[model samples]
Target: MSTEQVEVLVVGAGQAGVAMSEHLGTAGVPHLVLERDRIAERWRTGRWDSLVANGPAWHDRFPNMEFGEVDPDGFAAKDQVADYFADYAQKISAPIRCGVAVTSVRRNSGRPGFTIETSEGTVEARFVVAATGPFQIPVIPPIVPDSAGLTQIHSSSYRNSAQLPEGGVLVVGAGSSGVQIADELRASGRDVYLSVGPHDRPPRSYRGRDFCWWLGVLGLWDLETPPAGAEHVTIAVSGAHGGRTVDFRELAAAGITLVGRTAGHRDGVLTFETDLAANIAAGDASYLALLREADEYVDRNGLDLPAEPEAHLLGPDPACVTDPLVELDLAAAGVTSIVWATGFTTDYGWLQVDAFDEHGRPAHRRGVSTEPGVYFVGLPWLSRRGSSFIWGVWHDAKHIADHIVTQRGYLAYRAPRPPQ
Candidate 1:
């Protein structure tokens, strides 16, 4: 295989990878982006057809390119998001080598660069940006029994409820992914079972104001500087989808059964905690109280506000009248489909770098990793609460790019090769 050298090499060309590449280009850095498949393949292939962004279109864009005239509160379809990313790569003229699968990334011993081994070839770079996101890895809980004989699939593999086995569908995990999947499955005429878990609660709207509008007033999006020792706050808040906080009362009213975490599934018998209903109720209350506090803070601060319409906030009153944790034998109920919207994990086995923490995330300070010249962007939270969001990534990308330029002396160092 032929070897080529560049100043920087970016792995994975998703939203994060493309954003990092754009920033690097703005800084006049000589870099190349390696993607195992075409850019945004995850979005193109992993998401469901009815899957719309829980957040509005405004939050789904990348650096400098606004998702113009799109629906404000309307969710952008997965295809639209993929198309937007493709257009973004084109507009930025990102130096991307598509179909180049980075098999491993190791710190070049005794050298000031990193070695990126790919199926295409190997290349060395003084700087590496691991924009491969956390969602690449799917977490399949070990507790799910193999003999259950139900068609089980993770959120990444689930494309639609049509693929579900003919029967009631159980969606485990009440996070954004799980809730949305459950809602979609229910709408598709399936008896949907939702398993609730500990989740952050926010009103669809507070005081007739959209939650995002309040987030903006509270500096949620503009928080570029993270609080001391509060790095996880960024990731938690950005990945959070307040709209996924469905009205349990509404769900119950609609005849959907809520359940506790799946303790274990075996021999087609699904067991749920009896306290599942109480747990969901308490969790929803806690979330609502937190949102109220956030609203109060915004009012007290007297921040400038926009004229956007408010979202409808559902009260804690139970929407569903049925027992929360009613377990049904899947074999008896004829529930053949199980959608595991449990959540995602970060898989960095292919990345041979040393910057990852025990959780397999790059140990970084504001996008700058411990390994010199290595950086990351579009993490759940890179800087503040919104850093992982599309709009948030722009601010972060600019900052990381600026940091890279300042440290690498891009203004002084001439590229060994001309621009491609």
Candidate 2:
């Protein structure tokens, strides 16, 4: 019923949205940011208590503000990161209206703008930035069948190991989240089984230096000018799992049993591949080789490093063997929980725009959508390796903000608002 007008409307006030808002403010762009809940609620409520940033603190900051100079190697605790975002919002005085959930975002047919229908009211804007991150939706494998007896929870719902039922707990998905949760559960005295998948694995540190330092020195994180003929190449970096390469060898040393990808779960029986260990080991070696190549390139470039990258001697590698299919009797193992560390999914059902591809991702070229005046930010691989990382969003945000300013005069054509 109530209507407001603005030059720009930014949806979601998390890292991406906030970054965009900061850039717009710096450029004196008039914009309104709408957040469904308080900023950084995902980090405050969705993450576990013991979770620390997987990357160094330097990589965890937003645009101009850094997370501080201390604890560069150690990852920031979740609360610390959340507080940083809160402080950032206050520092910039971002024009954010919290507690307003956007129900729909449709192009105003006659106004050349978008009408964002929210729980509180409706707002119209000439340009819309879908900064709503990709993690809002969780992807639970359909292969996981429903069983009245076994309890299953996604990584988003999991807070700690205490929530699991008493028995051998099976954690599905061996990504960073899955691996970390499995490690915690096993350490908590629960017999844990981990389902491995196709994931990037790296050591938290190689030798004694943090892995990120090498990444930065090697220009792995500095792909602002991508090489010729490699425009579509996406450099892999760590994300929510912590930017640090996960050390699979460390996981094995910790006595965690690795299993194959989860096939299905029925009647309290979970089926997985028997060659999981071999697959995981092979995957680990491949990732290590990539890092080695990166290190070599850095050295060849004669880049002076503050610290020497350590060569990780993983030791005489164990003979690869097929993962034995082993089912843990929950009752016997006292494992009462199942945490699906499987990654996230993207859902844009509320967006009434034809800018997305078949996979539901916004069709964009470096943040500019096919639909004029529509833009996207905070997506994985939006531009380069660090695009979606906490510190990486700023680069894409600045570019998008610049584009919006340069093209502002051309967006005068207005579309008609749909009949209310």
Candidate 3:
């Protein structure tokens, strides 16, 4: 393989990777970004055609550049998001090596950096910022067997409601993706069965403002995340479907059968627990707790704003509280498709360094790894609740860039001179 060297090697070209590059460039750090495909691969390939960002465009801008004349209240399409990242890369002149896939990474035992093996060449980087991106590994049930006639697809691979076989769709998760897809299929006149899980179901807009506004105003964004109980619970926000809250109550009301956690599948019989009500209650409890905290904050600050927020937060729809479907016979019930929106995982096995814990997760401090110059970007719970979001990545990228520059003595650095 050929050889290349850079002061920093960024392992992705998504929003996070582009943001990292931009920040590093602003800090005058010499770096090159390596992308397996091209910029915005996830936006182009990972999402469905109708998928819109769960957050509005205004909240997802690049550092120092507010969304240019775009509707702040409107959620962006996948292509729109991809365009934003592309624009950011061009505006900052981010040095990207597209079509270069990082096969493996190892510490240069003799040097203070890393040796990253890629598709095109070997890169020796003083600092390796892994922004490999999310939805890395789709988590599916270990027990799913190959049924002769049924078609199954994980949410990661699912493009739309029309991709699956014509029959009832068993959507195995009640998070944003699952509900959105379920609603899509339901709207298409397909019978949808939603496997309920614990989730937070705050309204999309509360008190004449987006719920995100309340989160910002209440300092929930400041939360050091993987926030105790919220580590596993998904925030069920649906920007597609008119930016409304994807409440389980509404789903149940629409004739979607809400079942409990999938116990397993055996002999054409799919088993689910009787804990659907419990899961819904758990989410409502958390939702109420969040509202209580926000209420206290507003009261203490004398911010006498909207009175409707209390109503929105306190009111629980009776439809959401429901009995669980204990089990369903897949063959008899005519459930021909199963979509697992079970979430994602990552594999750091390619990294030769000991950057992982017993659980095989990257060990890092606010994007900075304990393993010297090796860092991570776009990791959930990296520093704040927003770390995985576009807004949160900015903070983490800024910190990572600052640390790399300050520690490696790059602050007084200058941009490379143009070719004569």
Candidate 4:
């Protein structure tokens, strides 16, 4: 196979890869970016239809460009987000080659670099930045039994409710994606049953400001790891209906049956834990904690923010919580479909480097792996709480680029002088 040499090689031409290219160019590093599919392929195809960004336009963008014509407070459609990254790549003239997939990466023999094997050819680079953002592989729990032959799909493959079989849909997982899908399915007049799980219910907007703004001001977004009891908590906020807080109680009142986490399956019958009320209560506790914190911040700083009188820490328990279902016969409930919005996991089998932990996650400190010259970006909590955000990726890219520039012996590979 043909082989080429480059100073740096970045994998995945999504927003993270593109951002890395921009920073490397600014630092005058001779690098090339490779993508398995088209640029922003995940945003282009992996997401469900009718999905919008979790965050609003203004806050979920790169520093170099603004989402033109998109309302600052309004969430942009998924296609709009993909288009924004594509347009940003064009504006910056990012050196990206799409449709070129990297098959594997191994340490170069007798050298201080890596040998990357791609579908097109081979590339030898002194540094490799795995910008393949989070949400790489869809994760579907194996709790569902195989005996029951029903239509099942991951959230990544789910498109619309109209395409589903005409029957009740059981959406397992109460994260942002799960809740959104359940809401959409229920709106389409399908009987929807949402499986509740540990989640954080933050207000979409509070005291005349978006929750994102409050998080920023309150320094919650800079945390390196999730708070205690929230390690597996999925954020249960929605940007639909012009952005609103997701209330499971209200959802139950709106006719969507709520069930606890899936315990096991037997004889075409699914068993649920008795934690429905506890799960909802946990979410409410988080919601109230955030509001109290925000209220204190406003009062301490003497900021003139409006008060939400209706915002309370407690309310009457919904029927789903008070009397949760312990089991459901798929046939009896008429549930014909299941949408698994469990979550995603990264696949680094192609990366043949000892830069991972026992759990197979990259063992890195703020994108810098213990294995020299191997870097990571665009992962949740990589460096901070917002590391996976658009702007967060951009900043992390800059930091990685800077590290590459300042490393020892980097002066030997400085940019070549232009022709005189």
Candidate 5:
């Protein structure tokens, strides 16, 4: 196939791609964005039906637009979030081609940039930006052997409780997705057993402010690395039920069983560690530590935020945590389905470049790769703690766009100027 040429080529058309396109357009850089599916395809399909933005609508949006007339504190539905990106792309007049999948990306030895092979055709570009987000590949651990005969699904494919087999569900992983799925399943009258893991529990709201606000003001969001001892900790906050603190004990009281980390499964029987109590205590400690930091910040600044005394009090441990069930027979528990919310990892198999590290992850300094003309955007902690979401992606995209312009000896074009 004949190859088309462009100044820049961007892969993926989600929030990151669209944001990058917007900045690139402002910088007068000729670029084309390629998407394998429709715009915002992940939000429209990868997420569960009841899924909502983990961040509030006010804070989850790009700086150029608000989330319509929705309440700022409320969570926007998954479809709404998708539409937001689609609309943003349109508003910015992004040069995007949906249904175009990038098959391979390689350094063009004969040229100064990359040779991008796409489903439509090949493209030679002076620069390339891999704007694919972090959640590329869903990770489902092989804890449950195939002989178990239980229907298995990843949280990414889960739609609603009605989609599962007519029985209990064993949700492995207690991060945001796991807890939300478990909560929804139990509310739909399905027995749910959530596997507890190392997680950080943050209140949805405290002191008349959202926990996200606290993180922002306390500078937690800007930290390049997680706090000491919080490494690899999954946050257990939820936007469901009008936004509420995720208390596994409360979930237990509501008839959902909370189990410790899953060890292994054989012949339809699952085994768990006897560390449920420790996991709960660890979450509580993180919660209290966050509150203490916020309290100290308040005292230092002499802010008028009211103290939330109840937040500091820990209620009695639930039976599931104290005397946890270490073994569970899937058939006995009536669990016919299993939802693995373990998490995701990036996939750069298509990119045959030296831009990755030994671990197969993109190695870059604030989105600028060591390889010239190779840039990455939208990976978590790529620049700051807020590097993945809509707001953060915008800033990261601008930084990348600026870097691209500066590298090419073009003057940086700031926004708020009339389009040429």
Candidate 6:
């Protein structure tokens, strides 16, 4: 029945949590970070075996910590990233209590704080910062049919093709993970059907450099997302020979049958809308717009950057959809496996608060939660588009730390440090 109290509680231990802890430490604030598993647990168990970061290691680290002395432009694989986070945790001596699953967070009536009940015990937190990184649970469509007898998997649990049953694979979602997994499966001689949706189609390299380089110089990360929709995005990056891209066009060209977004499913038959052309066009438009933005940025900055190169791997042409698949008979198509690359949604089920919206997402202006003494970090568009990224969430961490110190009078309770 062990219980403790802390001035602040950060509810995760990934990059966001670790970085937030570092910021608190720098502010001389005594905070405890609790995680259900080890630090970077999501990166360890959530990703596939062949997954690599969408961006380079040189630019992916948090403030004051460098990915130091590594390949400046190389993409780190899954294990490498896990190691990186482990190393970062070690470097800062982050105050993280592993294997502590927080099961409840309720308001306290006597004071401005939260009563957090965890697997280990309980925490009385003056201010609660929820850094519960993205992808709380796999977002499978409500329309998914009874895949009774078939081996089904969400992309998060899928490791490699060898683990799948010997038959065709139907991958739903055309995002990075979907595309990459489908491509890999197809390469390994499995007949793969990739269901497409509106996805960003940025090239692997724009000029003579990786597209990430251009994104930094173009000031795009600082721009506001349009009100209509989310900014075009994908982490379908690779570090193979000259780099492998996770483009739908490339996937289509590589013999993976392209289908439209999953509409619904009934009696082993999956229905799809026939809008493949429109989705492909939307992706192409985003890419072209990005290139134009980069070109204008180069001209404005007077930077001597090279011109954009020739067509990369047959850009997504709508003409590829001549024989599109509208309804797929799962059994007849020999689809023994269905990998739901659908996406993810955050879960605040245990956080007993009324701060969430209709979509079950926490309503926050920046990182400040609608509920007092509570805050959210590492969410898409939290402060900017990049706020969801490892390198971007630091901005919110610092802001939250400052807010706690200034608004909550948290720095008043910081414990004195011993002589170093």
TM-score of each: 0.85, 0.86, 0.92, 0.96, 0.95, 0.91
Q: Lowest-lDDT window of 10 residues in candidate 1? A: 232-241
Q: State the lDDT of candidate 5 residue by residue for 1-420, as single tens digits.
A: 688999999999999999999999999989999999989899999999889888899888999899995699999999999999999999999999999989999997765788888888889998999998989999999888766788999999999988887999999999999999999999999999999999999888889989989989988778886567765679899888778999988999999999999998877789999888889998999899988988999899999998889989888998888889999998988999999999998888888899988888788999999788899999888888888668999999999999988877743445587888
- Superposed Cα deviation of residue 315, candidate 5 (Å): 0.7
- Return the lDDT, model 4, position 185: 95
* lDDT at 210, model 6: 73
Q: Where is the poorest 10-residue window by lDDT in model 6? A: 311-320
Best of the candidates, TM-score? 4
Model 2 residue 280 CA deviation in Å = 2.0
Model 3 misses residue 114 by how many Å? 2.2
Better of 1 and 4 by TM-score: 4
C-alpha positional error of residue 236 in candidate 1 after TM-score superposition, expressed in Å: 12
Q: What would the per-residue lDDT of candidate 6 be over residues 170-201, giving only the tens digit for each residue?
A: 89888778888888899999999988888777
**lDDT at 291 for candidate 6?**
71
Q: Which residue pairs in candidate 6 have backbone atoms (N, alpha carbon, C) closer than 3 angstroms, thus clashing?
A: none
Model 4: pairs clashing at backbone N, Cα or C within 3 Å: none
Runs of candidate 3 exceeding 4 Å displacement: 302-304, 313-321, 410-420
Residue 140 of candidate 3: its Cα lDDT?
A: 86
Question: What lDDT tens digits, residue by residue, belong to model 3 across residues 246-299?
Answer: 667777778777788889877888888877888887777766676666667778
User: Please, what are the lDDT tens digits per residue for candidate 1 over residues 1-420?
Assistant: 678899888888888888888888887888899988888888899887766665666555764677654666656777778788888999999998899888888887786778888898889888778778768778778766766677888988998877776888888877667766777777778898887755554555555455666677666666766556544211112122334445656665666777877777666688876656565656566556657666577568775544222333454545332444445688777778788876677777876667778776679988898777778877876877777677777677788878877877754687688788
| Residue runs of model 1 more than 4 Å from their true location after superposition | 221-245, 290-322, 410-420
